[model samples]
Target chain A: MRAIVLASRPVGTPSRENFEMVEVDGEKEKLRAGQVRLRPRWFSVDPYMRGRMNDVPSYIPPFRVGEPITSEAIAEVIESTTEGLSTGDLVRAHLAWQEESVLDARFATKISSDPGMSPTYYLGAMGMPGLTAYVGLFTVGHLREGDVVFISGAAGAVGSIAGQIAKTQGNFVIGSAGSDTKIDELKQLGFDAVFNYKKSAPKDALRSLAPNGIDLYFDNVGGDHLEAAIGSLRNFGRVSLCGAISQYNSTGPTPGPRNFEGNVIRKRLEVRGFIVSDHQDERVAFERDMAGWISSGKVKVLETIYEGFSSLPDAFLGLFSGSNNGKMLVAL
Target chain B: MRAIVLASRPVGTPSRENFEMVEVDGEKEKLRAGQVRLRPRWFSVDPYMRGRMNDVPSYIPPFRVGEPITSEAIAEVIESTTEGLSTGDLVRAHLAWQEESVLDARFATKISSDPGMSPTYYLGAMGMPGLTAYVGLFTVGHLREGDVVFISGAAGAVGSIAGQIAKTQGNFVIGSAGSDTKIDELKQLGFDAVFNYKKSAPKDALRSLAPNGIDLYFDNVGGDHLEAAIGSLRNFGRVSLCGAISQYNSTGPTPGPRNFEGNVIRKRLEVRGFIVSDHQDERVAFERDMAGWISSGKVKVLETIYEGFSSLPDAFLGLFSGSNNGKMLVAL
Candidate 1:
């Protein structure tokens, strides 16, 4: 079996040299009493993976060098020794980037067996990313009806779902994306307004789009976008800091929003940073609401997938360059 | 009667030239129905007043140039035309920097009749500043017992009270101040650790003082202090952004904390910016708890008062220079 490993930590922006594909003996270890053998059907490559590559203290430990990089993945249970005793069952769990791997049965969650649904949705809209969007919007951002909501990285995995969810609640939703195609897709997804951040600065775009001021900001791309959101937010505005893809690969510390004192203090704003995993308490509600939204055509699921496992590094690298429109995934 | 007016708007830092003393007829306006004639006895000079000097949108409106600047004050009601029956009563209200003024009685809260309590305490420890510290620590920061708490501008009005309140909860309280005197004062106030930020960088001081990292930061001085607090905060840390005295006088936009993305997001921190006025709903509880704390000697009240009403502008400008050890006030 083949797996991708972190060859070395990158100095600044990561390159292909930082990752290496390695051959692993799939059948070397026997399945223990509480373990199951898995063949990953789909592997998720996200911007957060970049943080794991660095030797820094964070919520999750850094990815070990010379080991398979672990992330959320959907796999098939080839064999099982647990009480559940399931073979050919589709499960979702935090797994290594490999074609074949063994996992503790307790760590894996049995995916929805509905034949009408795509198993890939478990890695995007109905999975971690979906829960991230849901929690970031309702729990963190405090999204309310009639709120002028702004989302950065609008066409990306979490942002797309967050924007659509806000729209469902009759919010005035504005989104900023890197490409014209993403902006168009966001508009099609029922965003009140969309702008290509690559051409128009987020600050200026927000001024015209949300002429009054935004009530809530779903921040994904940090740096300039975060600054712009802070500047354009109305009094008592909220900011849900979900991710900062813009500063993830920076070599040195990046300067934060200059108007933090003038705006955040004067406006009495609430800027909260959160990780989706910490909000797992909302999983039941998230899964129910998200599934309903998707089934009712309220949320349009999108993904940018790679053909094979060997393209995992490329798929991960593309996130930095805005190569993927939504969730970036690799199929086995 | 005499009043100080805004002579001109400040460019960078305010100076004596920006204020003017003018003579006014004390009896020109009659105390109408529902109004009271006030003789201001003490005036408050706060850092937030600097924001009002500029014509920017904020929770409070900007002070009109060439008009008397208004602030929290303790006034004696010499004449009352309202139904409240307030003759010889000391009341707290937002009043002008004038010897005599007529204001609606509804805006004023009658001060406690307790003979042992000083009238000046209403302008400091028993008033807005006291409520600010209480709300920032308990309501916003969600301070827990045994948590390590860091406070910037710890010798100032809000920070001093905040540190003491946290101390009462058996929390390890660390404080950073601008001068050796302030540092010594903070130590006297029962801070577990105190450092002169002028002599040592906040980041280095915090690293040595709080080796395990802090759980909550009461930020009265933003900019570098904020950056240091964010860097030193542990996972799930909370910051109560009360004021940014360091950046209040800057001509240009001051660069914010550089590690915002890395620290705030990775640590899942909550940074809440607030003004004391917004939390008036907590006044009843604040008055009860704070008065009890002060009476029991668990909280000590401190004030730096300038003599005479003529010192209003100087007292206000002194805030930017760290001229006052605690709450800066001008006594008439």
Candidate 2:
């Protein structure tokens, strides 16, 4: 079995040279009782992985050099030595970027059979990406029925779901995307307003689209988008800070939105930075609600999948370039 | 009777020349029904008043040129035609920078006298200034028993009270003031650590003082102070943004602290800006708790009283220069 390892720490933007594929000796350790051996069918290459590439302190531990990078992967159980286990069961596991993995049964969760739902959904919409959108919008953004929401990276996995959820709740949902196709897709997804941030800027687009002001801002891509949101936010507004994909590769400090603290006092705005782990208590509610939305066709999940495990680095680098429209995934 | 009026809207820092002392014809209105005539005894000059000087949209309307600057003031009911017959009664009124004011009786709350406390205490420690501190610490900051609190503008009206309150609640309170005298005053006020921000940067001071990082930041001063708090904050830390005194006079966008939004993802910090008016529902609880703290000698009030009605603008101008140690008030 082959696995991808970090060859060296990235200076600016990571490249293909930063990764090395090596064969893993899976048979070196025999499976113990309550253990399972699996073959990964699908894996995720998220923008947040860029943070782990740096050898700095963050919410999660950084990926060490010469070690296999790990993320959420949906796998098929090939062998199991645990009770009530089957050979063909589909499970979600925190495994490495490898073709095969062996771990304790406790570390993996069996994916329940859904007749029409694809198993890759476990790696994107029904997994971390889905929950990230749910927690950011409802929990952090404090979404209400009549709120005017402006979301950056609107066509991405989380933003698409967030926009649909906001529209379903009767909010005036406005979103900004990097491409004309993404903008059209967002509008088709029932977003009240959608703009291509790459062609123009969010500041002017927001001004014309939301003549009134944004009540809640869901920030995914930071920098200029963040500044526009801060400027457009109404009094007593809220912002759910998710990710700053624009600054992930910068070696030095990026000048923050120049007027961030300026409006905070005069407008009484509340800006919060959060992780999905903090709101794990809301998972039961989120899954139940998201499932209902997905099945009812009220919320849709779109994904961009890359074939083969060797294309993992390409799938990740695509995030910075805005090549992938929705959730970027790699199939093993 | 005389009153001070804003001669012109200030460009940057307001000066004594910007004010005009005008004689008021108090008898001109001829006390209508449901009205009370009051003699202003103690009027406050707060930092928030500076934001109102600019003719821009904010939480409150701007202070109009040729009009009196209005703020929280304690007055005595010298004449009244209202149902509650009162003479020489202390009351809290939303009066302008004037010697005498005629207002609807409903607008003022009659303050009951304390056995040993001075009536002017109502203008400083027991009134809006006190409530600002109380609400910012308990409701906004979510102060815990063991929280290591960093309060900027520590010797001012609200910050002084906030530091003592945090210490009384068994929290490790650190404060930053402008003067060495104020630093000594904060030490006497039970602050665990006190630094003169004028002597050195808060970034260096915080590094040595709170090497482990801070739990909560009560921001009264913005710019460098706020930047330092964000950098030194612990994971999952909270910031109760009460004021941003540093950027009040800037004509253009000031360069904000770099990399402020960067750590937010990994550290999961929450920064909320709030006005005291937003938490008015907590007034009853605040007064009950604060009165106990004051009466039991757990907290103390400090005031820098500027004598006479002609000194209103001088009292207000002194705030920016750090000439006043505690609450800057004008006595009539």
Candidate 3:
């Protein structure tokens, strides 16, 4: 069995040298009565995974040094000792970034590979990134039809999916990307408007596009984007703070909006901060709607595929620099 | 009829010199069938009135220089041509700062004074200040029992009443006042703990008082108090931004909490800003509860009385300097 483990905590941005791809031979651990053994097929390299690598108090615990990092991944079951699961079944499991994983059968669920869909789709559209978008927009954001929504970091993994979900809800969706290519891609996905925030100031660009102002702001990249969104919000607006990728690496103070007090008072706004784990009860509801949307071609999944599990650090670091367009994934 | 008019806008804090007291004598000329002429008995000098004096955007229109300032007041009908209102009837009306006003009969709600209660009670606990605290705490803050509550400007009108309400609901209430006397007054009013924020740093004071953390923060002074509250919030904390008195005189950038992003994310906090007018539908509920609380002695009211109506400018300006003990009012 082989796994990529963290060598040490990085000071600023994580690098490839911080991880080591190690191989070890051991006795074949037998599966317990209700256990399953999986051969990893695909792994998710999400921005949230970066948080897990650092020693910070977040929604979840950080990964320890000299330990295998685990995330939602697509795998194939080689042996199973449960009533529902059987050997040779393709499944999704809470597995590590390793070639093989032994876990309880209940933690693994069968993955459907329909005629046109690839196995990689399970690790993305039907996976964590998709669920993150669903809960953040509908549950936390309380999104309604015809609402004007602005998605920050719209070219990234969760933002891309969140924008599409808002559009599907009959919302006027605007997205901000880092590059012209990503901006064009968002427009192709039926975003009412798209802007390259790297080229134009977010406040000015959003002001020009959304002359009427934003009703709901789904923030992925925080800091200036949060401030801009606050400035551009209409009266009685809703702000859903999902992530703050822009401020994650900074060591200095991130000056929040100067007129936050005035805006909040005059607009009578609601700014709620949330994480996906808070909405565990809605997971089943999310999966049901997401699966139907995928089947109906009403939803689309984009992947920035990075080859080999050893390159996980690069895929994770790429999130901050806008190196990936969609859910950055690593093929095992 | 005489009125106190805004002669000119003040440079920083307003003073009595900024108001011009003029007198005029006239008959009630062709008053409408459902109209009455009333003499103001008591007038409210609210902090929000300061915002109206400036030409800045607020929930309501700003007051124009050289115009008569208007506020909610209790008055006596001196002349009546209306079916409902009669001469010598005491009523509450939304009118101007003049000694006499001609208004529609429908705008005046007749009052029957209880032998035990004072007419001034209506202006403090049974009126706008009462409803402001009610709607802000329950509707916006989602206040719950056993929750630790921290209120800024705790000796002021709404803050004093709000602290008692939280205490009655079985919550441990902590309050911040300007002077040690006001802090002692808050403790005497049943605030579990109180601090003199003018002498003690809010963050350090709150930390020592509520080491476990605050569940609900009612923010009236927004600059450092809001910053301190944000830092001391517990997980799933709720912040209700009612007013920002600290920033009223601020001409420069408002310095606040530096790590706002981290505080919001780590706590899963909900920060909402509201004006009582937006929740007009809940007035019936507010009035009912407040009446019951006052009648049952479950809640108490306090007011700072300024003797003459001519002293209104000083009363309004006194709010910024923390000169009033409770709701500041001018009696005619």
What's model 1's TM-score? 0.97
Clashes of 3: 1
**Which wins on TM-score, candidate 1 or candidate 3?**
1
The Cα error of candidate 3 at residue A327, in Å, is: 0.8
Model 1 misplacement above 4 A = A83-85
Off by over 4 Å in 3: B10-12, B15-18, B24-28
Model 2 gets an lDDT of: 0.87
Docking class of 2: medium
Each prediction's DockQ? 0.80, 0.76, 0.63
Write model 3 residue lDDT over A140-233, tens digit each, in one string: 7889888999999998878888988888789999999999999988988888999998888999998899998999999888877888888899
Cα-based TM-score, every candidate = 0.97, 0.98, 0.96
Q: What fnat does each of the candidate structures reach?
A: 0.80, 0.78, 0.55
What would the per-residue lDDT of candidate 2 be over residues B1-332, giving only the tens digit for each residue? 78788888888888887889888775756789989989888888998888888888677888888888888888999889997848788888889887778899999998878785777777778888889889888887889878999999999999999999898889999999999999999998899999999998999999999999999999988999988998999988999988888877777898877787787766888888888887788889988888899899999888899998877888888999888887888888
Q: What is the lDDT of residue A81 in candidate 2?
A: 98
DockQ of 3: 0.63
Across all models, the iRMS values in order are 1.0, 1.2, 1.6
RMSD of each: 1.6, 1.5, 1.9
